[model samples]
Target: MKASTISLIIHGVDVDVVYKKVKYLRIGVYPPLGQVRVSAPTRFGHEQVRLAVIERLPWILRQREHFQTVERQSRREMVSGESHVVFGAAHRLQVIEQPGRERVEADADHLLLFVQAGSTPEHRLALLERWLREQLRQAVIALIAVWEQRLQVTVPQWTIRQMKTRWGSCNPQTRRISFNSELARKPPHCLEYIVVHEMAHYFHDGHGDGFTGFMDSHLPDWRSQRRELNKR
Candidate 1:
């Protein structure tokens, strides 16, 4: 069954509630404007959802405030025993001292970060970002190739960026797609979804009926992928 959505204003906050066949209620505060969304089971009505929103109003406002406070940044410290996500897996960071070369290697359950002695946080962060970019690049290239043949379309170009508001974007005129470098931190399948989502824009620009239809035909569970991408 198709989901139905309704809008509600709770304690001066606008919330979009979607009723679906899920077993529980989930509320998320999204970025760019801290938009709040709630997924309630089909059995729940406006009052139930509204009460849930009311209970979480304080948390919702705090999330909104957090988004307002920080646009985007790679805030991880270059230290050992820290948590870092690479390709959707939680890897323990193991910092090792080396000279002249800063590199990162992902093992079974740990990320081996080799850096020069006394390397600053910024230095190590830059090194890690570079590594993530390369990883994202390789994955996106393969995804683009697969989707290109599957969709029977050609992409002019694609690049990775540290985007603050979007996972991916496409220019229909240029046939160029830009993926967020942050995709490296998410699941591999999320990267595939972004590639397909951007490439689909070649046929449909805005997310209207045509765009939704195209996405549904190609990636039937795109909505779930999108939800996972936006999980808080």
Candidate 2:
């Protein structure tokens, strides 16, 4: 069956409406900007979909508020002696300036960033981002190895990159995953849940009953992990 798309504005909120061959209506609020999306049966008219959105107005607003809170807490300022998160632990960043190769080392409580002398803030931030990507890489590699054995599916490739909203995404078609580098700043368990969630897509493509069942059976604590991960 073919699908159609349309835009909507309810109570000053922008929504994306998708009409498809579905049994019922479904609404979702995505991260980054709390994008509102509605999926409805093609049989439903525009007014019917609008009424459904109106009925769920309060719930939609609440979800948007939650997204805003998470965003504010995730903001980072790359500087010395600033608090940074790695592997779910808080570490103070110690920026060291010297005429040496730029590198980063981490101990229990500190991230020692050795940078070339007289580096700009942008340069420092870029170096830190690169380091964070590497950190996420190592962690993801270890987690994927364990999950591949348990789930019995191999991931061909994965990349760590900055994402505005999602923690991770899977392109099952390509057998590749894109992980949010910011996960390095979140709790370790939270990162684990994201990895598992994305890998589950190898079997289930959407957040439907099948996907939920897959997650519940494999990572029973995923719901709690998601709640904690969304907390400010």
Candidate 3:
């Protein structure tokens, strides 16, 4: 069964339609932005694919709405009353001006930032970024340890960094995984999903049947979590 791919536009959304040697049609909406992709039998023509997308247009719009309403929040000013997310919970930020160590503390409803008086917004942002990075790193490390034992694979290294397009990535040859720093702002389960997804790559490099099967066996609700993560 040979495979080929092409692109088309439906209702103003760019779509990637893949012709594969398969039995049924499958469609998916992916993130950072909602990218619509369809997989159809090689026998299906472009018109068939376009009609399928048209049938799912409502669902596609809903998925895009989730990304816009949840994941694409307004720019942060890092000031009091600003909304911040931690562990999937929304918290209001409270900046406390004090001549002490710059740090962050969080309770159920507030992310308190203690900074010196007259600190610039840039300085405040830097402090928050460092704290978020540390938080993400700790979460990634703990998850890696757990998955490594379960998957029976030794990860040589892993790091948390800003990624514009991916939630996480793996280099199986190097046994290293890199997580997006933004995971700190998403729900805990989302972070866990990315960790396990990357670790699964240790056994399966691509998102083919083998990898999908492995994920289903390990995390039954992975698809749900993945949708939520992309919405963040």
User: Which residues of candidate 2, in runs, are more than 4 Å off?
Assistant: 1-77
Clashes (backbone N, CA, C under 3 Å), per candidate, total 0, 0, 1
**Candidate 2's residue-wise lDDT over 1-232, tens digit each?**
4566677888788888887779999999886547688999989999999899999999999998888787777656667878887867889999899886998899999999998887887788788878888888888999999999999999998998867556788887997899988788788899999999999989986566677889999999999998887555
Model 1: per-residue Cα lDDT over 1-232, one tens digit each: 5566667888888887877778999999886538788988889989999999999888898988888676444367769999899999989988999786678899869989899898898888888889989988988888888988998999988889876556777888999889888789889888888888888878875555677788899999989988898774
Give the alpha carbon lDDT tens digit for every residue of 1-232 in model 3. Answer: 4466677988787887877678999998777656677888989999988999999999998986766565556557778998888878998999999986889998999999999999888898889888988988888888878988988888888888876447888888998889888888888899999999988988886566777789999999999999898763
State the lDDT at 156 in candidate 2.
91
Q: TM-score per candidate, in order?
A: 0.73, 0.75, 0.75
Report the CA-based lDDT of candidate 1 relative to the real structure. Answer: 0.83
Local distance difference test, candidate 2: 0.85
Question: Largest lDDT belongs to which candidate?
Answer: 2
Model 3 spans > 4 angstroms off: 1-29, 33-73
Q: How accurate is candidate 3 locally (lDDT)?
A: 0.84
- The candidate 1 region of ten consecutive residues with least summed lDDT is 68-77
- Whichever of 1 and 3 has more TM-score, that candidate is 3
Winner on TM-score (1 vs 2): 2
